[model samples]
Target: MTSTRSVAACVLSTGMAALLWATGLASPASAVQAVIVVGTPSATCANPQHPTIQDGVDAADAGDTIRVCPGTYNEAVNVTKSLVFRGAQAGVDARSGRTNPARESVVQPPGASTGFTVASGVSNVTIDGFTIQDSEADGINTLSAGSGFTISNNIVTGNRIGINFRSPGTTSTDSRIRRNRIVDNNNSLPAGGSGVFLGGGQGTDNLSITQNRFGGHVNADVNTQGVLGGGDPAEALTIASNTSVDSATFLVLINANNPRVQSNRISKGPAEPSGSAMLVDANTDGAQILGNQITGGQGTGIRVAALFGPDPSTNMRVTRNTIRSRTDGVLVEALDSGTFSSNIVENSTANGIQVDPAVAPVTPLLFSSNISRFNAVWDARDQTSGGGTAGTANTWRGNVCPKDSPDGICR
Candidate 1:
């Protein structure tokens, strides 16, 4: 298995040419990029140029590198240039029961401000390896319309929102957020904050958020909303291989286009009854929810519904997910033209897999190769116009379950 740091390095290298082009630099060979050092002088970062991180950033060129030494920087760092900001132990996760206080770089911003602010129109910036906490706002806030940012290997906690991409329009494109520990950002719970919030915009395109550990968020671990004033949909947004625990909601995708959510471990939803482990709704089309391990709390394990509007979810492919819940395992409402296959749902207090009849049409939906059992009510229940598998408009085949509503649907 490849390490996350190696993978991030490879991904960063792939975008090097684009970064050079975006900065209007001739080439890596031609550009005279300098390296500025911050904090006290050391063996690795000798002859420190700037005493503070913001001073180093302000003095550097667009493509320069800023190396910060191990120290606590109690100030907000505003990044307006496309530079690489590397801290001590950059691209390394030191939260695996290792306490290296002498080798850690920490940033704690005061008042209602962010720790790191990647200003609007600044692209190709890399922020790696820092413990950013105790901010009234986000730990890292990327303003609208920036692209090609690589944020990795940081521990962001005790903020309102850990990492926020506040795109209003002309969305941020081709950014990567990976290998970070984003936890306990529930300080602004009354205002509904999240670990990572992708705000409303033209919707962020080609944004890859993967391999992060998230916990104790008030709203959700990962939350995305589509175009605010209605423009293009968010395309190719991938959320994969994340472990999210003890959040109000694990993942929530609203109106995303063809999003791929794969190989995530989601556990312990909020204590509230309305919380869900995963929710893909609000006319989100072509969503692929695959190969996830989910353990629910008081709410459903997986829910697909247009709770905010009347538009139904369409063309969703939910496959090979294992879910165990205190409430319903899977509850789908206001969906159309989807396939639910090869799922293992069990030990639910309510129905294992239920398609609600009260909402919009769930027709042309295929339920096949599923194993649902040990639910308190019916294992599989589709309360559509038809009574059973033979009469319903939806197709059901090769489902192994103990009990089903309107019978003859389970084999």
Candidate 2:
């Protein structure tokens, strides 16, 4: 067995330098240092660390701790010190996001980009529990600039761009890209595989992407997002409890500033013309789409668009979601205002909750206790007198549409 993991990494390299001096990454004058085992012998550490986890991160020092262990590892790392590269017992039960699969820790890296380059003055780094599969590009990359990063519990699959916090023109603050799994990333086009592509060039601050699990890919917008925000706004962004299946176009695509998409779990697999599964296109001054459970989509399951213009999306809150869609399951057109409550729109091919027909002094859309059934037509639609947004004024109370065709709009 590869010489019993190289004699269990030379007897765990003398007990990993006394467990790296009781997990403090030992540096108190090296406290009798002597590690660097690499493949088998349970990997190992110490002696400024090595045995390839990038040569113990080029001989770790800045608060060292390069554990690694189990097996596979092809090489493509760059990470510039400031360490904490685990994998040995990974996650240790941090919600069992993996690890202990025979001491896991893979990192394939066959041709090129191959994972881990975390550039630009690498700050407070911490990449835990590895798997990071077939990557031709992006699997934990930060092109330029860095900040306190804590990318946790990993698995990240076939990549093209699975976690690319593209720090193009600077700005990458307090990061915490949490609990990961990220499936079939960018299966090569359909927005080219983005399961977390914070593209906002000069953006991001206090970012916290929670419990992740983005979908499998073969094309459902081809994993266009599981979290693909970045066009500047993000100031204390927090996308909660993530989970997606077929993922098409979005499972959270932000233009943050008061962003907080809570209790996530968007179903939808076997791809399709899947477009919406939450796309807060231009959140300005207001945001919060709570308690999610959106179903399949072709258009809206939560698409509040304004196309990133003069802060178009003003005052928002689409609550208690359960949305299912073919089109409008909550499609608040061109912003201007928001407030839809206790939602539960089912089988909609059209309008389950749509307040479109823009242009006007329109800023008072408040539909309450929502509940639209088998929608085919108007379970709730305020196309504001349809004639080109004439003085749009929508205010429906206690909604429950599709009873009498178009009688007083789902009362």
- Candidate 1: what lDDT? 0.81
- The clash count of every prediction, one per candidate, is 0, 8
What is residue 309's positional error in candidate 1, in angstroms? 2.6
Q: Candidate 1: list runs displaced more than 4 Å.
A: 1-29, 42-45, 166-173, 226-230, 269-274, 386-390
Task: Go through the candidates in order and give each one's C-alpha lDDT.
Answer: 0.81, 0.66
TM-score for each predicted model, relative to the true structure: 0.88, 0.37
What RMSD value applies to candidate 1?
7.7
In candidate 1, what residue range of length 10 has the lowest lDDT sum? Answer: 1-10
Q: Model 2 over residues 102-157: C-alpha lDDT tens digits?
A: 55778877664657877677777888878777777767776466777787888777
lDDT of 1 by residue, 1-411 (tens): 111111122234647867777989744444467777788777755767788999888888798888889988999999989999898979796335326656778898987889999887888889988888888888998855678889899888899888887433334447888999888887655654588888746677778889999888868888875343324567778999999888778888887779999999988854643578898777688999999998867778889988765677789999999998758998988787789999999999889999888644555788999999999998999887654366665788999988987587789
